[model samples]
Target: MPPRTIGEEFTKGLWHENPIFRQLLGMCPTLAVTNAVINGIAMGLATTFVLIFSSIVVSSIKKLIPNQVRIASYIVVIATFVTMADRFLAAFFPLISKDLGPYVPLIVVNCIILGRQEAFSSKNSVGRSFIDALGMSAGFILALLILSSIREILGAGTFLGHQFLGSWFEPWVIMILPPGAFITLGILIALTFVIEHKIKQRR
Candidate 1:
């Protein structure tokens, strides 16, 4: 592998280090709200906001926090952002917020967000941390979008509440169920590995 440039850091999470397919972090919301496209998108954006801001803040204040208490400090920072995001969504997007349920509050403990803070942000410069956050958030959102699109279209025969399939097409009730979430995610993960392997072979 070549030495990584700053650009690589920002772009790798799109596929190479995707939080869902690669790292397999934050499975709670990934599986819980992905029954519908709108719910998935709402959860993704809310998580993105929390992840980015928390990374920025954690990186900026890393030095000031003691090693023993760094994890606690990081949680506080993450929780603050999560609270803000939760309230913001509730205020403006009540319907989506309701649909998302407790998953939004659960972002404070999401492994993807806290993992980056502990592994990257706590040691890196603010700029690098921000880029990492951006990449991770983008990857997360993309994963949610793809998963939700597959689920909603097949399960409900709709895309964001708009019917896409003709009357001839019957909805797959299983696609909207828990088993469907696992099955879809499993297939996507396998497909991701195959693509990555092919790319590696090409190189």
Candidate 2:
């Protein structure tokens, strides 16, 4: 691989170092909001917004902060964004915000955001950090979509609330449960590794 450029930093977030499927960070939201497809998308987007803004701010001011207090500063930055995202969702989409519950605010604690700040934003330029954040957000959303699609269709016989299963088909109760989320995500994670491994071998 060539030395990474600015674009690569952001683009890599989408696929290479995806927070969910690639690194398995923020598993709680990955499983919790994924009970329904809509919820999954909402949670993903909310996180994306927070991640992008936080990265931009953190990277921009990286040089100003002392190393000892950097972690605390990052948390404050992340928490601010989380609050903004949470309030926006509640104001515009009360129903979704309600469904997501405190998990929305918990975005502040999501390892993916903090990890990016400590690992990437602390050293990168603002533009690079923006791209990196966007890419990671994309990766997170992709994973959420895959997981939620499976759960929604299987658990409720619906796709984004539209019935896909005919009347004759009964929904699998387990697919909507917390255990189901864990088992399904585990399988998906395993599959992701298997597929990636094969691609690597072929190359």
Highest TM-score against the true fold, candidate: 1
* Tens-digit per-residue lDDT, 39-60, candidate 2: 9999999999999999999999
Task: Look at candidate 2 and give me any clashing residue pairs.
Answer: 10-131, 10-132, 13-135, 14-135
For each candidate in the order shown, give its overall lDDT on alpha carbons: 0.94, 0.92
1-203 in candidate 1: lDDT tens per residue? 88568889988889999999999999988999999999988988998899999999999999999999999999999999999999999999999888888998999889999999999999999999999999999999999999999999999999999999998999999999999999999999999999999999999
Per-model TM-score on C-alpha atoms: 0.97, 0.96
Model 2: per-residue Cα lDDT at residue 147:
95
Q: How many clashes in each structure?
A: 0, 4
TM-score of 1: 0.97
